[model samples]
Target: MILSLIVAHTRNFTIGRDGGMPWHLPADLAHFKKTTMGSPVLMGRKTYESIGRPLPGRLNIVITGSPKPSDNATLRYVKTAEEAVKAAEEAGAKELFVIGGGSIYRQFIDRADRLYITLIDADIEGDTTFPEYDVRDYGIIASEHFSANEKNAYDMDFITYEKIKK
Candidate 1:
């Protein structure tokens, strides 16, 4: 399975605050949904709790120390990032999206084959942040710049990066 990470972060790398995203960007949300529509998504327990439910049309694998039973067919639990990846592969996922808070990203960033990043051009204050990564590790595949709008509060760039072969 191809491991990919999808994230939206501020210029300062802030991803969340008070257990939720700091900005309201509908376009980014739509982009996220569209990109991960048919793929399995792996996330940490805190990220799962923040979403509060399984995403439709995709497998939702939550990595946590404590596993939980789920009646929701799309939702499942795993003990570690490796287990999450294994589950996605077992589910026949061609592309696995690692949608995260922080620690989860750190755990799988090195293993990620691709990155779909929304770079918000604002220094929003937040307690939770995206992990700092070396851009030299990946090559930009595509990029789209969007100006700030009434709903999107800040200008943002949607970028896709493919891991550079060693």
Candidate 2:
């Protein structure tokens, strides 16, 4: 299965503040929903809690060191990234989207085959940030720039990158 990392980060790589995102971008949210609607999405436990519920129409896999019973049928809790990937494979996923809250992003960056990144056009303060990776390793497959509007807090670019084959 293809492992894809999907994230929306500030220019400085800031992804979260406290337990939630520091900015609100409805357009980005819509973009995310459209992109991963049918795919299985894996996120860290904290990321799952921040959203407060399982995202409908998709399998939600939460990676936590402490596994617990998930009341939602669409939600599954796993202890490690390996289990998360295995869960996706078991579900017959063609691609797994790694949706995150910092730590989870770090665990799978090197293994990621594709990156769906939303680059917020402003610098924002946050306690958690995305890991640094060599962009040269991935070639851009698509990109579109969106100017900030009433609905979106900042200008952004939706970019998709696929890892360069060796």
Per-residue lDDT tens digits for candidate 2, residues 1-166, read: 8899999998999999999999889989999999999999999988998999999999999998899887888999999888899999999999999999799999999989999999999899999999987889999999999999888869999999999989
Compute each candidate's TM-score over C-alphas. Answer: 0.97, 0.97
* Global CA lDDT computed for model 2: 0.93
Against the true structure, whose lDDT is highest?
2
Q: Which run of 10 residues does model 2 get worst, by summed lDDT?
A: 64-73
TM-score of 1: 0.97
TM-score of 2: 0.97
What lDDT would each prediction earn against the true structure? 0.92, 0.93
